[model samples]
Target: MEAMPHDPAKPEFTPLDVPPGGLETPYGILYRPLASGLQILVLFAAFIGGPAFAWVIGQVPGDLSQTARDVLFVPMVAIFFLGYGLWIARLNAIAFHGIGLGLLKALFKLIVFRRKPESVADFIPSRDKLLEMMVRAQQAGSSFAPVGWLVGVIAGLTAMLFDSALHPAKLFLLVGGGCVIWAHLLAWLGRRNWLPFMESE
Candidate 1:
């Protein structure tokens, strides 16, 4: 009997099954799930703080003079975008699904878009040497947990206080209270075992 040709549009099937072991990367790194505490903190900051800060900006009075509004909006937008980009990058690092692919996307911009080095550096990892340092930090089980989170929180609180006091048209109570609500949600989620692992990619 003659064999029939397979259709090109049809999908191919493989008998192979996915292994349960850690995921391996072409760079020879095996990405694994993150610790519970780390996951909670990561997600909490991204989901809660990200939106709250945006909300506060939205609440800023539009009636302010153009120059004043522009002055405030410029910094607010910069911080919002920076926080959002970092959040996604950190999530991908832990998830193993974001690093190489994300890097490739960034590289295209560098090549075709004529993006500046400093801007590229912000999105991409430093040089190969710096990436090596990051990998070493990951392998040694040493993380910046202790003071890193504390400093970030303190800095955020300080910024909030300054923004409230300086921007008379902004509703200080709403912004500050929203931050507290965001933090409370994070603690609640962490306690409920709803957080995911957040280790580096």
Candidate 2:
């Protein structure tokens, strides 16, 4: 028997069917799960006395022993890599799942309607309403952790880079935050856009 066709507007994916390991990417990649966390660590590790470490590194006491210098430098190196790696990985996720897919959806819509645009407007949702939507996505067996682990990393990066290059870390945090937010947004846009890996198509 011949197989039945699929519908694009209403993709086979639904919040209830989101993969247990991670999200479905816009492309065929095995995307990571969407979530956030580790607030207190981010708070103290990145802020508070974090700036002091950079300052200590910057104006090291001329008489201090080489051993003292090594101690300060090691963690800085570790933080530098950890902070940078997470932020970059987060960006890759966003590029593939968020921005890239969003563009694809726009293209799909344009091709379908000749750019006339379909009207799907509604009133702006209140904070509570938005929170409720997140809850709903979770209730449907979808993974939706709203805590960002990058916060502490970004904070650590901020303290370390306060004297040199602050912008990179801040930019990374912004991009990462935007990425997570876009993932949250998928609770609404996922099924509508025929996203890849979402339905095993």
Candidate 3:
């Protein structure tokens, strides 16, 4: 034992294997990468776009008295949920239980995406086309992610209209359900034509 040599460079050499049904970042509990990345983008757009949109909401020079915060935050939350569910589909290699865990993790981390500079920074690298390919390899739904964001924005606005009586519950039910249904629909439509090589290992 006393004669054992230490290798500083190889410190602990941990394998980068995601657990059978779990995920962790060096920072701690994370979702599958593509989903994580999409959530991060939604977070990024929200923080960057939220305040400005909020200001516009207040300044539109009309009877519209709503705060800019709602204008920004609603879409942010909506898209995040949609993106999150589709992201879960990517991890289908994992058990359904694991996917649920991943989805829950994504929901929990929703707030984490709000922490400034870091949030914005995360989105920048995800713009790489190669990164999308990598995400696809993992079975994450990159194809519909953009459309998911659009659908999320629409759903968010719709929720806002019904907010007075519905509050947050409506948003959750509608957005979450829509994401699941649309994702499955898209998957089905693409099934016949989808290139199998695009699937993950």
Quality of model 3 by C-alpha lDDT: 0.42
Best by the TM-score measure: 3
Tell me how far the alpha carbon of residue 64 in candidate 1 is from the true structure, in angstroms, after superposition: 5.6
lDDT of each: 0.42, 0.37, 0.42
TM-score for each predicted model, relative to the true structure: 0.27, 0.26, 0.29
Candidate 1: stretches off by over 4 Å: 1-49, 60-170
Which rank order by lDDT, best down to worst? 3, 1, 2
For residue 88, give model 1's deviation from the true position in Å: 16
Q: Name the candidate, 1 or 2, with the larger lDDT value.
A: 1
Residue-level error in angstroms, candidate 3, position 139: 8.8
lDDT (tens digit, per residue) of candidate 3 on 1-201: 587775533323334454444353333332233354554564455335434443443343233335423553454344444544555555453433333454555556666775333232233222232233333434443334465546655655554554343455555455434544444444332222221212234
TM-score of 1: 0.27
Clashing pairs in 1: 93-201
The candidate, 2 or 3, that scores higher on lDDT is 3
